[model samples]
Target chain A: MKYTEEHEWLRIDGDVVVVGITEHAAEQLGDVVFVELPEIEAVVAKGDEVCVIESVKAASDILAPVDGEIVEVNEALSDNPGLVNEDPQGDAWFFKMKLDDLRVLDDFMTEDEYKDFLG
Target chain B: MSEHSTELKQTPLHALHLELGAKMVPFAGYSMPVQYPMGVMAEHLHTRAHAGLFDVSHMGQVILTPKHDMAALEAGLEALMPVAVSGLAEGRQRYGMFTNAQGGILDDLMFANRGDHLFMVVNAACKAEDIAHMKAHLADVAQVQPVTDRALLALQGPQAETALAALVPDVRAMRFMDVLSVDTLFGALWISRSGYTGEDGFEISVPATTVVDFARLLLDRPEVAAIGLGARDSLRLEAGLCLYGHDIDTGTSPVQAGLVWGIQKSRRTGGAREGGFPGADCILAELADGPAQLRVGLHPQTRAPMREGTEIWDASEGGQKIGCVTSGGFGPSLGAPIAMGYVDSGHASTGTPLWGEVRGKRLPVTVCDLPFRPSTYKR
Candidate 1:
């Protein structure tokens, strides 16, 4: 598992990278009320904003961690946005991306390093 | 986390907010709690179900006493706002606004007739100017004294009576809009049976020194929970209440904001005390002729919140801009997105269909009657 500075966590599953926000980000956002997911098969850059998350307090954006194509998204979030706050790193995974080369993930922080980065 | 963190004012309950793991944010030049550990959603729902305590110490509290007699002070107040200050029966409070000569609202406020004197509560952001405005206009007839040693707390919800009456039994006898001072073990509590939330509640003004203890006593009840600014806003919005600086502002007139109810019949045309206040000509004319724009409730057809500043367009495919949203967000109690904004009078009907542009997409919105949910005031 890897984490980005933008408070997103990525996990490799076969040839896809499952991406979701970190627990820290979810806690900061308070309660999630609405989520606008990106379209499946949409090509995105490393820094592209692909998702919009609205909480009871304010709205936030989820940036694509690395360059890839959005292959799948968590449709469950549309009906139950609270899942993002309930399980941010697991069932709350936003989408899966098909990266051309998975080695690019090596540059991201590991779980231990992400904790230090959060500090 | 603003750059002027050191300059922000702290309420008497600041330390207690921190102890409860509240997320403090800068609001109206004060370091206040935006939410507690329960979060905004839970806090909002909790207030609807039971009772929620809010520390509104940042709002301005002023006492206006007549140097000569109460009648003279009533006239002094009548000259500043459109409300009927003279006929405001003792122990009753009324909503009012300071208006500019052009008929625009300077600030919305609540003033109660406490028999011997008037107790006025103004918004925090406009406190300094509101105080100065009152002194400049009514100094010779009334003594405008700002009360800085008191903290205002709002106990709102269906169970508010159950929670507060347990401590101050006198409050149970008070009806909506009733104002009285009661003595308790804590101190002399100046309380009013009213609040911004559309709920049966009380707004208590307690001495700043003993506010923390009083807040803790209320929170210790099983029916009470500490709410924050975040939920306070959502609750008020759901109740169809206008927030100062939003929904209504210095550029909006009382008539355009649909606040004509605040103006007593005596102040209108052909009344006994007609045309004595500021902007009386424009306000009265608008009241009779009807305003060009009307503030109405907006119900977004989707789950996404259409926040403030979202433009409202006619329902046509390529329609002209008619208005802009002033207060918009998710309605926790209703489980959908609700908003209030100004629109052309032609499209202000309760069932009229409109369109609100959000983030580059035009979403369907309907002009619904205010207070998406029915207010449960103890009338």
Candidate 2:
């Protein structure tokens, strides 16, 4: 698993990449009321805004970690957005995408490195 | 502390906020808590279910003294404000606006008739200007005395009264909009049975020196939690209350902002005090003939929140821009998105279908009755 300064987290699962936001991002947003994910089969570039999470406070964008085409999104988020706040790194995974360039994964920081970067 | 932190003003509860792990954000020149660790949603729900304490000391509090010349003082105030402050009965408070010569709002405020004097509280951002304006205009009749030593605290929610009564016994007898001067263990306390969240609550004005201890005592209650501006905003929005800068401003009139209810009948045409306040001609004219636009409640049909600045479209007019959302967010209690904005008069009716354009996507929205949730005010 790796994290980006934009607060997105990505984990490699087979040939696809699992993506969501970091717990720090979830906490900063206060409450996760709604999440608007990119459409499936849509190609996105690294650092592009792929989703938006709206809380009672404000709406924040979640950037894509690597250049890829989205294959699946967490449909449960539509009915239960709190899933992001409850388990931001787990069941709240926003989407899964096929990596267009594997080297793009190296651009993010590892778990320990991300913690240091946050500090 | 950094140089920036030194520049931001701190309230009486500043130390307490840091001690309680509050996330302090700069607001209206003061470093105030935006939320506690429990998060905005939980704090909002807690207030609706029980009670939440807020430090609102940043808001300006002032005492308007007429020196026993009530009639002269009343006239002096009426010159600048739209509402008939002179008609306010003892212990009653009225919402009002200081209007410009053009019928635009200078600021929205609440002033209570204290039998011998008037107590006014204005928004934090507009406090200095409002105070200066009062001093410059009403100096001859009323004295503009700002209260700098007092800290304001709002204990709001359904359980507010019960939880508050435990600390101050006399609070139980006070009804909505009732103001009382009570004595507590800390010191003298002035409490008003009113708040912005449309909940049954009390606003306690205490000596700044003892505010932390006084607030701490309330937080010790099972039903009470320390809420911040995050929930304060959401609660007010769900209650259909207008935020000063967002919903109403210097460019909006009371009639257009849907604040005519705040004006007493005496201030209307053919009444005793008619046409006395600033912008009277334009305001009174609008009263007789409806304004071009009216503020109304809006609910986005989808889960996606339609935030402030989202362009509103009249569904019948081929997606033409009719208005823009002023305040919007997810209503925690309703589990949906809610908003308010000014729209053309004909499109302001409840159940009127409309569309909100967020980003490039047009989401279905509808005009609805304000206060998406029913108010539980003790009144």
For residue B260, give model 1's deviation from the true position in Å.
0.8
Report the interface RMSD that candidate 2 achieves against the true structure, in angstroms.
Answer: 0.7
Candidate 2 C-alpha error for residue B22, in Å: 0.5
- Among the numbered candidates, top TM-score falls to 1
Docking class of 1: high
lDDT (10s digit) by residue, model 1, range A67-93:
999999999999999999999989999
lDDT of 1 at B185: 80
Off by over 4 Å in 1: B1-6
Query: Which stretches of model 2 miss by more than 4 angstroms?
Result: B1-6, B316-318
Clashes of 1: 0
Q: What global local distance difference test value does model 2 have?
A: 0.90
Q: What share of the true interface contacts does each candidate keep?
A: 0.83, 1.00
